[model samples]
Target: MNSINRILIAGSFLLLAACSPKIYGTVQLVDANLQPIQAAQDSPQGSIVNMINTTGSIGQSSHAVTVDVEGKFESEKEKVTPGMYKVEASRIGYATETETVEIKKFTGKKIEFKLKKILEGKRATIKGAASDEDKIINPGEVSIQPPSM
Candidate 1:
């Protein structure tokens, strides 16, 4: 009779635990100088958008998350098993950066990303294909001269 009571109690505890949800840490975006910049002042959305994905080796894939605008980026409170995740930031015309994050049981984390110059060079060469033969030729080098538009 005592054994039966112990089994019932243990089963009930497991059931409750399975239904509970766990929360993970967050990520942020910064500038190349490590200064926290607010996402674009003209951001239509109030919250920063973060896109999360996997990378690296098998089972060792990292979570690549990106946020546009300069602000602290947070992930949805998810029930994730404790593990090491490679968190990265993605943005158009911005160099992406990655950071390692450890997800704990309860505490949320703050990750930051600095937006480095996305432009590889001040000038870009415009190449064209020569009709005479399948040859590549540099038609011209377009300088990134900011116009007074």
Candidate 2:
């Protein structure tokens, strides 16, 4: 009976630990000049530090961290899995940044993102694709809108 009780307790501990999340890194938010910028610690949803999945999966937003006034952020220690993720940061008047990073299971690791200044009417197209390419993705019939009377 003593052995059985001990085994049960050990199993419970393992189960709880497995359910906990894993933290990727000690992320820090920076600006274009490579200077640390303090993120709003007002609310979790309004935080400047957010992790995005590069694969465009809408369901991968479970892990989020509220950056402190020192611009340092951290995710749940045991709720996140080790994998490739995009550490995104956005601030008013600053260009949004999405940095591709590989999150590891190791602790005390840190990731830094540098945000740029937003340019007016800046082209956001990815490189290597010609502007006048004949190939059309999701092509649809062109509609001519008559001038409103």
Most accurate candidate by lDDT = 2
Residue 113 in candidate 1, Cα distance off native in Å: 1.7
Residue 120 of model 2, lDDT score: 59
Cα lDDT of all candidates, in order? 0.49, 0.57
In model 2, which runs have C-alpha deviations exceeding 4 angstroms? Answer: 1-47, 54-62, 106-108, 117-149
Candidate 1 lDDT, tens digit per residue, 1-149? 69999999999987766544332233343455755546453221223333332332454332323343434455543423455555655555456666666655545556545555343668888987757588754669645677897
Off by over 4 Å in 1: 1-70, 120-149
lDDT per residue as tens, model 2, 13-128:
88766555343333344455766555562222234666664543466644567656455666665545556666766666566666676655443335665555444576696766
Total clashes in model 1, counting residue pairs 3 or more apart in sequence or in different chains:
8
Q: What's the lDDT for residue 18 in model 2?
A: 57
TM-score of each: 0.43, 0.45
TM-score of candidate 2 to 2 decimals: 0.45
How much does candidate 1 score in TM-score? 0.43
